[model samples]
Target: METPERGLLARLDGFFFVLAGLAAVYLAYLTLREGITPGWPMLLVVVFWVLVSYLVLPRVHRILSRVYVPDYFIGRTRTADGLLGDPVNLALMGSPTQVHHALRAAGWTRADDLSLASGWRIVTSTLTRRSYPQAPVSPLFLFRRRQDFAYQQEVDGSPSQRHHVRFWACPDGWFLPGGLRVDWLAAGTYDRSVGLSLFTLQITHKIGADVDIERDHVVATVTAADGTATVRVLPDFFTGYHSRNGGGDLIETDGHLPIIDLSRVDVAGAPEAALPVVRIGRPVQTVVGSLMTSVRGIVYAALSSLALIGSRDADEVTAATSVLLALVLGLGALGDLVLAAATFAGHNWSRLLLCASSVLGVASVVAERLVGNLGGPLHEGLLPLATSVLVLLALSSDSAREYALGRRRRRPAPADQPS
Candidate 1:
């Protein structure tokens, strides 16, 4: 069961991530539609699309994720790029040490964090037909962040094929149905081969046709080592079904979420700590800056389109007029950067300042229409106006309000010594 607020936020998150991905695809289509016509112009467009999709969009999603993605357990997790990913098919009830001991005893090695060095190592290992028992797994998101950690086992002496599962420590006070309680939730999947994504054409892992096999394998291994632990199956927790993952690979599952109780494993250590609630303002400015950076290409195009603004030929355009136009564009860009900085520094006044800018944008567009000077289908203020609205919405979200007002509880002070 989900609260109304959580439900609404989840829907918004889904919409934003999906739409942003589609926007990237649309940009790619616009750039490559001419079948890669010869010239530096075409090359630049392709390069720009790659940067926006692969880099800029991910940053935007990460920044906004705190606002719209719920901070509690959900049945499924998201991919690093915000696409819906593997289902949460397993839960563990135990201290972190117990879980760690059981998994290691069962022969599963904790995967390395995905970084440039590890990524390159895996690529080279695969090319050389060597084994990489602890290769890193691609990131998957739960609780609006990437998995806390992952564990994997190489298969058939191949670096390209493996079984992996990502774990996320459950939020404080979260509970499951049927009196079930867990300290960690996980989504396990098996990689059968490497292939290109049908949607984005990016090279990625292709999972085996059945994910249930790996899910059961995980349960069996843990139980074999920790026989005292209990096992409970939530029948049809996600009805057994078939679907495609973010990379468009076929997936099938039995839908039973197996809850493994390792509390009796006698492993003495601290349980996994719940994550603290992060204030929204910390990342909002970065999000704004990334959005602006993504659209800088559009700004450049608009500048180029003004080549003949004041005169027919390029040389006839007056120096004063050119300087004035350039100044206007530069100032606009500078304003965004300044606002981002101010917001990050916790100045609530900066948000109001941006809201005022949005109002001005609307007024200017209306005036242009009234004066019958709306020469183009899309007005100059359109992008800025849209951006202003989005910024206002982000700043006004409940999380942002809490952050702006500094409403969080402070830690208790240490007891004073006798005077």
Candidate 2:
């Protein structure tokens, strides 16, 4: 994955995601607490929480991660949508079992998976001031999915705060700079408190401002537990610096990626076979993903438009307006469908057309919002607008642009013969 130079609008859009996320989370919490009464009030809060946590926040992450996170590993961990979540300050070279042994020996407990049972357990534990050493940590995505495993150590027996690290198994055939091979990449952060983020205002773990402290803490504990454990800090691996995470929590780090090698330690019976390597062009992926976003936006817009037909203005609405709206929505969907087919077939113009359409759609949404003409429920307009922006940004990426233009060099289909 590659990150192109970000324009001003893109930067603002990226920040907007964080802002929107914080707002949503706060609203959800307020709804849950204030709406907790008998009957519908309680029901509404539950629904709001679910919608914000599961549906809305995930989408926000998807959109913002692309802008804030580096596409390539620059000694940092990336969120699901490509935003910088935490710095990848630690690396381990060992089999999965060996890693387990080392961490367990270091007195860290494996965190429970984030499921309904575990989630509820953590909430109750936090509220009741109970110890939950193996409490689940909220997952941050890497390699297109959540961390393969996580380990955490409770601080002062408090369920609300802990030292945690998430580890992801390295992709097959992938190597770090200088050919350094690490089995697992990790991001370690200390939860100073359970609180809302300063920027996003979302109810999330407020990590200690200095992440380097936590990074060294992990290395120290692990190394002390096992005599065989050793660490080699890649000097200035990420460069000594201070930064902020996606939640806008302050963080300082020495850019060095600590490489811990425990390969010699025997744990599992035998090492598993290396996974098969799969390769696909990043640009092609952008095109396909953008097409999907376009389709989603088109559908939302169409549904919103149809919903508006029931308004009192229906008496004054002419057939032309209805027909025009239907035609536009149909065309938008049809365009994305065609672009998806053509882009997959290696047609370059289709990619360009897709990008053009995305830009137009986003512009239209902005225009409507600014003029106070956006109709239907607020979410109806906001959701599609957000999706359009995401699609536009994806299509504008360097990878997408290069792929589109690079493919254009193929000689035109034998025009005379085809005709």
Candidate 3:
């Protein structure tokens, strides 16, 4: 029999990535149109700020960050936007089950996974000052994957304030800088209050200035769990330094690291058979790129449909030519849509096909502009060119390449014998 389905959603955030850029441009165009209007311009500017900050800036940062940001271990976590997020001040050497049991015993609650429902719930809870003990924490990346899980302690029934720690399982044969192998790595921080993210101007929780305090707080909590957990402090794992995290909040740490030994901790409910499941998902760039390809397909289909519809009044030869062109373009558009769907489903071949076509599309447009002396860097019909560029960039992104290759490598093996 076939294995049970993971039933994973093919979430191609790349579609949203391109949409954000398009929205930003549209908002800017609207702002220009209302430039002479007094109050409306200001309102539109704010709207633009909200959209650009949350959507466009993050993706832009992710693109640019690939150039300068080193992917090697830096004893820190990177934000979703690829900025240095939080310091890695804590480590662990225990099974995930023990860690879970120990943290719960120490009065920490495992946070809810981030989703549309949880996101809305947290927003409402924050606005109403309601206590949501299991509120989801924002993701941070280590080893190129978001934290496996996070735990938090809400302070005083307020969503704005909390003590949270995110954990990631250490890869095979990986260890600390000084050759100390650990089962997991963790970063802990205290959310003092909510404020705007300085880097992107998005609303976020401003962390406390000193992270050492939070690190110690985390170690203390776990050690206080009825003599179950023990701590071994690695002094000066990272040199004492002052720096700002991705959100641009002032943060200072003494460089001391704590390795919490949860091996001796108490019982858990069941075996953690699901902890090692394949974690393949559509990357932001790949999804956006694929969607952009679909947009091109839609455009082609629409143009062909219009051509067929308007060809009625033309002479015999003209009508026949129009019908032929329309049919050819329509079939090509249908194929493009199929390719996009396959790409979004994590097929490497489809992803590569989109990339190849996007390259040709962008090159052809630029070549036409240059050959025709169009008096601009690019020719007219900038929207078409822009979509092609987006499809090129998003699909060509490092995340997209990694996602495609990872998915390919992790695919199930074919059976030699039929069931």
Rank order by TM-score, top first? 3, 1, 2
lDDT of 1 by residue, 1-419 (tens): 88796577556544443443433443334344432555544564555456455544553555565467665555778776455578888999887777777888789998998877999998998888799999999888887777878889999879899999989888788777656668989988899888876544566788887888898999998898778878898888876778777677888888888899988887655454333344343544335533553365356446744733543444544756676666676666666657655655555456445545644554555566567665433323445544543454445433343444452223245589332
Pick by lDDT: 1 or 3, better one: 3
lDDT (Cα) of model 1: 0.66
Work out candidate 2's RMSD over C-alphas. Answer: 9.4
Worst window of 10 by summed lDDT in candidate 2: 273-282
> What would the per-residue lDDT of candidate 2 be over residues 1-419, giving only the tens digit for each residue?
32453354345444444444544454455445545656656666666656565545655666565566566667666544455778888889987778888888789999997877998999889888899999998767777656887899998889888999998898899898888888889999998888765444456788897887888999999888777888898887667878888677888876777888887765655445332243334454565555675577567467546845644256456655665666676666666666766765556567556555655665665566558664333434445544554554455544555555556544467756662
Whole-model lDDT values for every prediction: 0.66, 0.68, 0.78
Which prediction has the highest lDDT against the true structure? 3
Top candidate by TM-score:
3
Candidate 1 or 2, higher TM-score? 1
Better of 2 and 3 by lDDT: 3
- Candidates' TM-scores? 0.61, 0.55, 0.77
